[model samples]
Target: MNINKKTQTNDEGPEDSNVHGFTSESVVVSNRVPERSTKVASYLDCSVYARACGIETMRQWFDYHRVKEGGKPRPPGIPGDPSHQYREVWKGWPQFLGTNNVASAHLSDTAMSLTDAKAWFIKNEIQTVKQFRVLCTEGLRPPTIPACPEKFYNVKYSELLAPKSGRYLGFHEARNFVHSFEFNDYLEFRAYKRNNPEMFEKIPSSPDRVYMKSSPPEWTSWPDFLGYNRITRTRLEE
Candidate 1:
């Protein structure tokens, strides 16, 4: 059956009420079929199946769990970027949606794998499962949810696009972003710059700080957003 169609289905999950008005049968997921319906897991087994659901889908999860007795405000166990404050990520697995070990071990001790989680939710009547799975699995599409509730304002504009946008991963909207690092990434950035020397003349941003070489802010933005803070691009080829 075409999951994208907005047709009604008798089979739905208990979580359907948490779907925020959308129905699972009407949602469209990725072309890839779910892994296996029987693959089981527990809520704590999240590292393997937590998917980067869309902003709207995340909102639905938040709403669904908030009112439930001993509910969760966010999906548990998925590793979200600290910089982005867990609002969004590159991608996530959905099998761990409501896995709250602390809440109840009976339901959390064993559940479905991320692959089966989508189908399970759909079967259980979670209307947003199909759409949520698509947004997270496809990785390049915008959400179809219209007119979100105002309570969802906590998710930022950048957070909404971060999962789907390569641009957001690299720099802020302004492009000229200054980041200070002291770890392996800092070493990698410096090394990358030394390897591919740009012909573009670079001015020193901070004479005292050797790593703080400066150039046109707009130009710096181009390389930075591309994950090349150390390398600069120019119209002229060296």
Candidate 2:
């Protein structure tokens, strides 16, 4: 019996080549895809998740916890009490809404104001004991919330494009909108401070300090409204 043998050849033409037909030396290149700017814009649009919670609230909560735990101490033992256990129970709560989860709801209910909530947090949670007295003298001032104009309320995309529209204001509008007295009962108190420097000074600087020191006068400006103190001053200064 004779067997037929076929010879191998390299004559595979373009049509008979791989799906993306190309010579061994001819490399096929594709253009790079552009980045999606829409997502960035959307993120920018939605950056104020916690702005509604107010700056004073944030500061007070920070101070309360900072003092209570001696500024970021390790978690307590498993059999800790309600206050200590609450810390571990919701360690990642603030990452979700950028505010203390355990305290946010409580603050909202009792204070009916984020700032007041923070104040209450400091009073009840931080300064409840005598060992935490150093926090009272830290001289950390609560940030003033900004005044969000009517433009902030208008949600039209076209309005966002406007130069002066609140949507375009970015962090300024978000931070201020949350901190302003418009969302709380302290509007009259805040306004009174703004109108009368001497009288405002007579009021305590911090709710904690009210029992300890004299208050400062209230002043209003785009800076105050946006909580644009020395730290945040540069964000919108230009």
Candidate 3:
């Protein structure tokens, strides 16, 4: 068991001697926990380490890390228990809140917070999921932003950043909405969007690619959605 020598000393008050054998210096100072180098030993459910480090209960450690680390790059170790796995380090935090629950306080990579990243999307006019992906594939996205922001942030793309790659009206809803436009065919629908980009800001520019991949249940065919079937039937009758 490697002990942090930095936390070994400190002669202060009565609370100092209350902890099993560790000192206040070994635990927390000014509401700040130790750095990643600090080890939480796996014994008695890490009671010794937890108490020494100002943690009242085992479950409190989750809240501790959430507040301190923004729940990114998990702790170097988790206290051993029946339900929890014991490891020196976790690669990342699991999906929970699916929101920017904490400020980007401990993130070392980019200074941009979740809010900042979202703003960048709007500023760049990245309206659809496909467009965002193409930018990432072409190496046009900034290094400060992740190509898969959902994984990095432990939240779905639409939840963290809306539209994923484009507007996602539910499959049936999208089909109905597109049909209401009275487009003669898929090509005509595409041309309409291209010509009147501002009018369709909330709608995806490429429904065929975007909706087909996303909407598994209600997605039938582009021809059905874009009124191409109706056009084909009319042409055949004529």
In TM-score terms, candidate 2 sits at: 0.16
Runs in model 3 lying further than 4 Å from the true structure: 1-4, 7-62, 65-177, 180-187, 206-216, 230-238
TM-score of 3: 0.32
Prediction 3 global C-alpha lDDT = 0.51
Using all chains and alpha carbons, the TM-scores for the candidates as numbered come to 0.18, 0.16, 0.32
Each model's lDDT? 0.30, 0.29, 0.51
Ten residues in sequence with the least summed lDDT for candidate 1: 207-216
Tens-digit per-residue lDDT, 94-140, candidate 1: 32343331233332244333324423333333234244444434442
Cα lDDT of model 3 by residue, 23-132, tens digit: 54444433333355556544432343455545442244454556455642333454333123432232222111112323244343663666667667656767667777
Extract clashing residue pairs from model 3: 76-88, 128-165, 128-166, 129-165, 129-166
lDDT tens readout by residue for model 2, 1-238:
1111222256433342222222212211111111223222121111121122222333343443364666432122211122233333332223322444434434323332333423333344332232222333343322221111112222222211112222122333333543443322245545655777563443422222232111121234434443445453343432
Pairing residues by index, what is the TM-score of model 1?
Answer: 0.18
> Which candidate do you rate higher for lDDT, 1 or 2?
1
